[model samples]
Target: MFIKNKRVTLLSYWTSRYLLTLMIGLLIISFISALWIRHTTLENRLEMIEFMAEEMVNRITDVSIPGIPPDERVPNFAEDRFRIRDMNPSMYIINTDGEVISSNLPLEQREQSTFSELINEKEEIRKFTSAKNNKDYYAVKKKIEIDDELVGWVLMVESKDKLTMVKQEYGQLAILIVGLALLGWWAIYFLSRRLAHPIKQVAEAAKQVQSGNYEINLSDHIKEKEVYELVSSFKQMAGRLEQLEKTRTELLAGVTHELKTPVTSISGLLQAVNDGIVTGQEAEEFIRMALVETSKMKTMVGDLLAFNSFAVDAVPVKISQLDIDNFMKDFLAQWYAIQEQTDIVIKIHLLHKEVMISVDLIRLQQIMTNLLTNAEQAISGTGEITISLSEKEQYVSVIVKDSGSGIPPEEQELIFERFFRGENKKYGIRGLGLGLPLSKMMAQSIKGNLHLVESTEKGTSFEVLLRKEG
Candidate 1:
């Protein structure tokens, strides 16, 4: 037979263990306290009996005749003569021969031999059991003297049942201990439940997320700092996941359409030429159009592969030190030579100081190319693209500012997210939206960063930071 293990929840786990430990600790303390109270009560009772015995002895000594035997001189004690309020013990006067001369004991307990046998002559206080009544009693004794000669003992005997105060105290103590234990258990039960509640909600939320449901609403009004932070962070993460899911869906449709357009165009153009629909020079034009569509398709495919490789750290970088001023001049000249926009002007503002920076030449070229292309595209009819360079402490910044309408405020934060395109550019742009994100990734790979300094209706500015070589 297989034995299944029982699972304990957070609430039960903490409360049950704490209650067990608390109960054990309370039991140990109560046990020790009960013993101390009982011992102290018994000692007080014995002391009271001893005090009464001494009083009776003094009374008998005062009434005795000189040289008279205690058996004849000592009188029987009256119940009221030595009694202090409600406390009364049986009083006895015994001779030196162990014979009870006189006693205030009742008729049934007045046997002289049995009473004498119960007293210990050497002890001032002792407990003894009577054979006739089979009852326990505490006996306290004081010696009687006449003319400085020992006569007998004045003994006080009280039944153990009369000391019921100890039992009453034990009852009160047990009640107090049990009351405190119950109070502690109640506090722990509620406190453990309060602590476990939020964690349970978070566990359920995690399950929902695993099932691909990103919309989750968790309360953030918790007073605990750590739990509040946990709930707030999970909410933000769910919001981001929801946005990414939407972007992925849009990207799938966009990529399919972008790739299919070129393929369809190429197929139609080549088919027309082969069927002799156009003659001579017209046929050559048709073939040229097909080649252009093929080139566009190749560029798109190359971008997708390159992005995947860089994401996985499969791309290698070859770093080399280059003088900033000279490299910028050569790089801008080559870039300008390829651009067909004659109306757009490119201006350079280089720093007077010579700054040497460690960078991979090809990666830096790619970063500069993407930034310049973006700036060029942002401009409308006739606008200027300013390239300024500056040096600070241990880094150099290359700023590209364009006198074009700035990006919408809402789209600025998401510019560096993969597969995310701005509302304005999604329809007008033909390529995949990987330019800025890929550029940022490459910048980070080379120990640098790229960020937008500011963007307004006047223009937009982007800054690229590179570490200065030692």
Candidate 2:
């Protein structure tokens, strides 16, 4: 069905290999058949012709025609007794003077002396001979006696039917083989498509699976055993597709819950402002809330984009040397108001010494902000949130812990997946699902990682690891 060109399709679809194999097979079979038939037919014809030539020679001597004397006449002849023209003689009878007296094939068989010369040879001669006139003969010349004295000779001339008929029959066989080969071309085309039908069905079924149908019913199409194997393999692949679809659905629900909260809050405050419910101080507070929502939206967008860039293996990293203690101090200064508002008891544990390492500043800030936001959400009413840093021989690690409702053991691993929120956490109050996944992605991008270290019903701690500067 490819529309590149009609002639191209005709050749490509059937393919020369099968056609060639079919052609060669048919050729060999047909050739043997035709050759045997032709060979047998011509051999039978030659045997019959040889018998007739022998009979004709015998008839000429035994049965003498009218106006012919038997005894004193030339006792020999050339050409068969069957006269060329019955009205005259068809054989050449030689006289005592070695001259022709009677001839049936007058122009050709008149060579009675030549027959006499052949018969006089030493060994008994009985073979076909060709004339100087390009005519051939299958004659048997023998000694004929009259009154016990040799007189003349006899020659039997037959046309070259042995070679002629064989050649003609061969032409007919050539035509038959050509016709059968043409038929073989059509046979190969249908056969090739029949063989490829199963492959095509598997491809079409896989396409339907890609269109999100996990339940692929391929019972009717896959009939042959070979085709069924491919179909079964596709069915197995469809199973994995089903699991991926379920994961995608769960991710969507989590993302929606995460987005709906901040959007709802922003809309409520904006609607209040529009209705002139509060002004002056209240208006300023609403404005600040709107800014906070805007900032939240911005963070969500950044997380999603940065995670995608990392997934594609293209996130840029600008590592620098900075004191980890000073970075945390600056980060706490920015979030001091949020901790105070939530009445969250905060504690920082780090050495003031310079903790130089390879890091991306903006990327680290994003990870810390997401972690702190998550920590703040976990603590509903005045609870302790601790930030602690430690350095290993070859890596730097930052740990954030919250004294709030920790993650369930079952949900601990899934929490880092994109758009996956915990079931027990309140959707309206908790951080968006993008935060942890984004933090994990950022950590891995700088040759680091993020993991939930330990969790219980009372608290959760998240660990971030980064390579120390070279």
Candidate 3:
């Protein structure tokens, strides 16, 4: 599609290569055909010359006149026959001494005729096809032989039917070819437009997709198979983009919901403290509550950022060999104080006593914290939160289970998105809804899946997969 050479385009759709090809091919073929037809004409003339030479020589030798005077004219038939110039316009003859006895056209000088000249110079014979005077002629010249002696030579010439027709045909062929080549240019222009038009439309559609307009309309005007298919593909792509945009919008609305609550609560409590509504220990208590809410707000914001983080400069994974059991145990100590507060039983179920694995310790702890926090929030007073691990042939799996009001099937699927929250909750803190999303993102970044195994009215369970150590 890109042209490196600029000299080519003489016509709108025409290129130098195409024009050169047509010209060269037509010229070569026409020239060769003309030569062949001309050759065939000369061959036929050769036959005619041979026949005429034989006839002329026979006429000269077989002529018999009884006592005809040398100075006087002979009988009518003999007189007319001896007059070689009167018999044929394209015929010529000569004596043994290369002198003309009789002629059709009178020559003022003694120079031999062209027909005679050719035979005289070549002695054997020569044939030629000439396209002089706008007529193609087949002419031949040869010496007359009798008793192994040369009396004279005769040249006979005639025009051929096929040669003349082919000669004329070359002109007509050239015109026809020129016309057809022009038509080819027209075809290229017309067809390329039909092709490029749809592609341009597709390009525009792609631009609109980038501009965040996902709903695209396609024209059915194109009847070509390939163009139609391209439009159809663009339409499908636009539809998918529309669905993704809808999902993104929903996510934004949800994040707004999460951020609004704590901010509102913090403002109200601070406003109460500043107005001198509560003083001394009461003011201190209100300030403490506001700080707690502010901390909670900060955590939610950090979780939101952590969950949706994507770009080139993200921290690379730092893997180290360590006992996952010991790692979890040391980390779980932070939450040990919480288990003592509630009547819920906490248990760790280990398939292997100690399984060594490689991962980022900080990120792994974050994933664990998120999962455990969600579990604790689900329980009201009396329940169990269990952490278990199992290794398959190729992968290791970790599970967290809680005895509490299970996640509703409808809400379970959406809970891992930013700012998503449970519909039914009697809680101290319904967070700005970023925990599960952060957990999911962390798990995915480590090439793992976090999934709900099962959820009932009494409990909910979650599974996490990770690659096993060799």
Which candidate number has the best TM-score?
Answer: 1
Which runs of model 1 end up more than 4 angstroms from their true locations? 1-8, 20-174, 347-351, 387-395
Clashes of 2: 14
Clashing pairs in 3: 85-103, 85-104
lDDT per model, in order?
0.82, 0.68, 0.66
lDDT of 3 by residue, 332-399 (tens): 78778555567777799776577776566777787888888788878988789998888865667889
Give the per-residue lDDT of model 2 (tens digit) for 299-413: 7777677778888978778888787888888988887845545678789999668877778988898899888888877877789988889997778889999998988886775
Top lDDT hit: 1
Error of 1 at 345 (Å): 3.9
RMSD of each: 6.3, 11.7, 9.2
| Candidate 1 C-alpha error for residue 430, in Å | 1.4
Of models 1 and 3, which has the larger TM-score?
1
lDDT of 1 by residue, 1-470 (tens): 86689788989999999999999999999999988887787688778778777876777777735432444444454535545333467777787766777777665666565556655546677787877789988878788888789888777777776743575788899899999899999999998898789888888988998799987878878988888888888888888777777887888788888889999999999999999999799999999999999999998888788788889999998888999898899998899788785688889999866779988899899899988888877888899899999987788999999998988997787788877777667787677778888888888888899999999998899999988897
